[model samples]
Target: MVISFLSALLILAGLVFFLGAGVGILRFPDFFSRMHAAGKGDTLSTLLIIAGFALYQMRDLGDSEASVSAVLVALKMLVIIAFLYIASATSTSALAEAGWEDGNDPVIAPKHENRLAGPPESRTAAADLNRNSTHDSQP
Candidate 1:
């Protein structure tokens, strides 16, 4: 019963991460901003959720039936964390390279800053196109 409750709590926390990611994707003004929100928020949130579940199952860790499953789940979580961190970092860098700015404002790639995105004109054009399609798809 206690384990079940903990499991529920952990899953709920994880779901919050998922919800956060969704909101970030929708609410963030740009691809770069969205990526930042999702990469950090979702990863930590899922880690917390998985840790909670691991704790919940600690009592059964030594059992012949559940030990293998628990270890496998834990290993899977580790792998997920590793891959996600790399992917998120690389993808965010790539997005910057592809000209994603943070916020809805026009940004000038200052000579001092290591800006990766393209010129304001191109980015604005893409933004306009995105806005058009998004608005059209709305109910």
Candidate 2:
């Protein structure tokens, strides 16, 4: 009974994190922020949920007939959780780097610009401005 309650608690906590991730993905203004929410929340929630499952599986371990298989199942869940932690972090970083390299800029409020003017121009436009300024300076 105690094991079941603890398992439920962990699973519920994981679900709450998952809900937060969903809201962040929907509400964050930029890709990186959304990815941050997804990666962090996904890794932590997966770990918690799987850990709860592993703990719950062990509840049957006291039974001689089910001990070995229950132990093995719990071990497998643990391994999965470990792999997910590494993979989620690595993938999130890689994706964020790729987006940056591809010129996806974060939304920064311009000091003098009116709020209703919408976001600044695209990265290509900025790059063009730089090139034009460099050419003007050279000659």
Candidate 3:
């Protein structure tokens, strides 16, 4: 009974994490931010869910005929969890790095007329034209 309850809680927690990740991915401003949401959320949830399943599988550990298969399955789940635990962060970092290398800028704030006219360095690429013009005019 206790094992089942704990497993259910873990599964629910994983589902909740996934839900939050979905919302974050949809609401976040840019690629890196969305990837952050996806990477952290999905990885944790997957670990929790798999761990819960593995624990639940322990219920059959005492059955002589099924014990070997049950242990094997639980080990497989653990291996998967370990693999994902390593892969998720690296993959997210890789994607974010790729985006950075490709020159994808993060959205710092909402687009508006005032923001457009704000500090020069904070301005978007479109405003870069005005900066270059002064240099071009000198030569």
**Among these predicted structures, which one has the highest lDDT?**
2
Q: How does each model score on lDDT?
A: 0.69, 0.84, 0.83
Candidates in order, TM-scores: namely 0.53, 0.79, 0.75
Candidate 2 global CA lDDT score: 0.84
TM-score of candidate 2 versus the correct structure, residues matched by position = 0.79
Query: How many residue pairs clash in each candidate at the backbone level?
Result: 1, 0, 0
Please write out the lDDT profile of model 1 over residues 1-139, one tens digit for every residue.
6777887788888888888888997898756677677777777676767667666656476669768787788677667767776786787677655553334333334564324535546555977878888999999
Question: Per-residue error at 88 for model 3, in Å?
Answer: 1.1
lDDT by residue for model 3 (1-139), tens: 8888999899899999989899999999887789889888888888989988998988767769878888899999999999998898898889888887786766666653344235545555545777788779996
Question: What is the alpha-carbon lDDT of model 1 when measured against the actual structure?
Answer: 0.69
User: What is candidate 2's lDDT per residue for 42-134, written digit by digit as tens?
Assistant: 888888999998999998677798799999999999899989988989999999889877867666566754233233563337677778889
Worst 10 residues of 1 by lDDT: 100-109
- Using lDDT, rank the candidates from best to worst: 2, 3, 1
